[model samples]
Target chain A: MATISIEHASKSFGATEVLKDISLDVKDGEFLVLLGASGCGKSTLLNIIAGLEPIAEGTIRLDGEVVNDVHPKNRDIAMVFQSYALYPNMTVERNIAFGLEMRRISKAERKATVREVASMLQIEHLLARKPAQLSGGQRQRVAMGRALVRRPKIFLFDEPLSNLDAKLRGEMRTEIKKLHQSLKATMVYVTHDQIEAMTLADRIAIMKDGVIQQIGTPQEIYSKPANMYVAGFVGAPPMNFVEVDLVKQEDQFGVILPAVLKGEPKNYFLPLPDSKQLETRENTKIILGLRPEMITHNAFTQSTNPEIECDVDLLEPTGADTLCLIRLAGHPAKARVSPLFACDPGESMTFSVDMGRVCLFDGETEELIRL
Target chain B: MANPKTLPGANGKRYLFGRLFIWTLLLAAAVLYLGPIYVVLSTSLKDLAEIRAGALLDLPHELNFTAWREAWSSACIGVRCEGLRPYFLNSVIMSVPSVAISTLIGALSGYALSLFRFRGANIIFALMLFGCFIPFQIVILPMAQTLGYLGIANSITGLIVVHTIYGISFTTLFFRNYYVSVPQELVRAATMDGAGFFRIFWHIMLPLSVPIIVVSVIWQFTQVWNEFLFGASFTSGGSQPVTVALNNLINSTTSVKQYNVDMAAALIAAAPTLVVYIIAGRFFVRGLTAGAVKG
Candidate 1:
């Protein structure tokens, strides 16, 4: 396995710059995912690492060797494309064996390697079939087989599971994770799917507009996002942002949250944890970021957690948990509570707010106010 | 609910009348198209005496093979009594090489143009497309001079060269349009698989090009086979293609015109293309519409 290092890489297509000065390092045998929305240059970075796209400026080193000018073939990298990109004209056996044949491996060895890969992918029966004859999941297996047969130093996947149905995608996701654990091969996967990144990556690099917003473990990114963008982009139902007035009450800093309870206007003061960052920002407007699960029904509360009574504006039942909509500081926000404890819409309900985990961001810059 | 059988009596009668009218028009059109073929077949089977005595549309008194044998063996064309056999061989030699060379070159160029991005690619493709619109009559003089300079003038090779050059523009257009619809990811995957330029082309692009290849082969063959201007202008005597020889045979000023022999010679010259169409006509239609929609 090889470690990939891309330093200050910049790419552009004519006048439009696709990848700005981006630097990233992937550890040996680590599964690193480049996660972002479309047009965020995650795929472009993957292509750059694969040596498929030329970098306008920067150095890319593989295994501590500068391979900026190496061809993709000589780079000893194998890639699985989102479309599978299996040679439609070749049978599965030949498709998986093509790289070995091109490398001038012996015919017998190539056959043995292909057979081994086929069995590993559980596609031995599909060896004689062309790609067109395979189902979506089967084609994905063959694509992986093609990559695995090479035993390359680095494996690149360009959103390989994006084309599969939801159920198939999950099964393949687990299969890929298991493969990674078993093989311990360095892999760089690019996708816009946060769930895939969270489940499959050892560390996820979240990008936006050609810049990396955050690069950390999935839990770190989910719990302590680097900015408003990262905070909003990571979670399902997403993190809620409410504008609040930071006020000082007897040397304890708190945020004034305006809410309507049972059709009556009420202002709640949610105290913030003591921090030098919040001390300097007293009496200033700031954005408070609260994850949905941080606010829950009162039954699952700690005595230390502050409580707020607000009218439930709407209710969205999602099997295990029901997301209730409530106004925080006059802005709508969602709170996750057990479906059993959710109240009907338009009724007042008490919610325990975990102020300890709330993220405070600069109102103007939108950068998180770290505690 | 509105089935024709379930319609009111008046509407049903109107529907039947409309169907009958369309059938009559279709039959008339079919006859108009096939009428000349019937006449040619009848004339080719008639003896000279029968031709003089019977009506043009009448069946021959008996099937006669003399005209066919004469057309194949000894019909005089431009004072050469060796008939269309040599000219037929010349057409075959010219069309086969021309079609194969033009199609191969076009496929390679098409593969490069559609998949590889380089400076001046579109300009080069646009110029090649521009060559397709240039009229054949406009290039005859320059083409003849080039052929004479190459010292292949008045030979099958010279005609092959001319047809191949003229055919490249069209063949390239056909293959380019077809290859453009192919996904670029296939090439990228192959490249990552350690296959280089020509390997990717031979292994991936070519195997996937069957439909377009059939289309190109049929188009170039038909055009080169029936082409008269280049054949007539560039070659003569022994090296002239079948179309030129057929013209010479029909236009020769004999003391008495032999309609049976002329008809037989004409049918012989047209037979190869007719056979090709009959065998591969379905593929030609399929190949034309192959890339019009995504799978």
Candidate 2:
């Protein structure tokens, strides 16, 4: 219902800059997620948007109206904190209705809104209970109900599911997605968990050291990361990086990946897609990034995709897929394979490399090479 | 570690001896502390003749209400024969407002100091803490002059003002430490909920402040009720607190001495504080420890 535009936003604590000159635009009804590890300033960015923290320099516009000095409440936004910051002394009913009360709404109207939100969250039976009496998941639901009761133009969530257990985290993540879909409200969520960001965000902004590395759809970021940092940060058993020599032979550009097969050293040349950018970098070292799923036991249909035999160093079973750690160009790389086709430790396995989806990065800059 | 059943008999004997020694020391300390209360009670119930004839720790021959009545309504302090009655009322009037005003202000100050971030917050807190260590004697002359300038000198109002001002430092210290353990997110959420400063304090901060409130009330009440120097310095005659009256009752020049009346009046003055502690003693310990451990 509202769009957030942050232009040249910068913040610092003492001498250490926590948020550099950051510019981001969140479209109306778009679920934008700021994803990064701790100290990357994702939470600080959320606070700045919430008006809980002030920016050193820059202006924030909501719905194309300047609101740099406006208070958070007047900006028509509600935030769900990671701690579930429900008023410990108030009942679930009051906690949800408190905002309306603060705005001087009538008691009867407040009660009705509380009922509607409680039913939507399936927490009607818990309306009379205090926060102390609820479980972690129940408290999380109450927090969401409180935000929903306000029906603000935008909703801000700061790692709202981080305090829940893994199973509860998954359930609440789905609930949040459902809430966003049903309400079509603008949301800016901050989290360090990549899975949450991947499943929930319409567009993910991956940040590092106060600078945003990439902002794109989950598919775009996963398949085409802007830099080596975004590539490694977004995947589970994260994307593997191997240094290889890019060479041109017979008018074709490819990278030579040294591998160990059955205690013997070998080299596999995986051809790169035709690009003028690749031609200029021939006979030079480049970093090749490959996702685990891209290197699997299944054979590729295309003749261009190369297959390499590798010695499996370790096996990690994750229910449906077992990950086999293998050496690619003398660096340990993870390859995802079906549990049925997975090879045990100290055995040889052939993994087909999907050359079409591989990423090539500059050795010195660590930035992705366009192709 | 050896099991008790497998241990030697000498160890059992040593354990018994140790427990006996500990119990003896504990009992002795308890008697030493309670010994004065026994003397005061016994003396208050005795007539002058019996008090002269009996030992200090001796039990009264029979219960008597004469001295109690005399202390309540008819004893002479200075030139006043109104006993401790009016002075006790003066103390209640002075202490109640002083405790309430000081505690409420302290809670507000504490809430601001602990939760709100502003320029020079730490420096302000440091100054207030410095206020706690300032001796009453050091400020008496200046305070008296200020009270005179304000036209409340030598009255119960002046004493009330004095006690409240002096009590703020300790009460603020107690409440501020307690409020720090509360999460900062609660305030942020309340702010986002459209609750302003006073609204948040009334709904969120005050409700969660019961334990600390009890602590502050007990602390300020006891201090104000027992204070003697300010009560004596700032007030005279009809406006003097019970402590001043009790002093005059015991130390007044008289041939007979009236030991029973002095004992009864002293007990009457100390009774309110004793009762306050007995009722809220458990919470005092709990609140102190609760503030000690940071959340």
lDDT of 1 by residue, B1-295 (tens): 5687665664566778988999999999999999999999999999988889869999887899889888878989988898889999999999999999999999999889988867888999999999889998999999999999999999999999888888888888998899898988899999999999999999888989988898899889999999999999999889999999999988983888889999999899999888888888888899898863231
Question: B142, model 2: CA deviation in Å?
Answer: 0.6
- Give one digit per residue, the lDDT tens place, for model 1 in A36-61: 99999988999999888988899999
On the 0 to 100 scale, the lDDT of residue A216 in model 1 is 97
Off by over 4 Å in 2: A298-301, B1-11, B291-295
**Which portions of model 1 show Cα errors greater than 4 Å?**
B1-4, B7-11, B292-295
Computed on alpha carbons, the lDDT of every model, listed in order, comes to: 0.91, 0.91
Tens-digit lDDT track for model 2 on A87-180?
9889999999999999999999999999999999999999999899999999999999999998999999999999999998988899999989
Worst 10 residues of 1 chain A by lDDT: A274-283
Task: State every prediction's TM-score relative to the real structure.
Answer: 0.98, 0.98
Candidate 1: residue A221 lDDT (0-100): 93
* B132-168: candidate 2 lDDT, tens digit per residue: 9999999999999999999999999999899889889
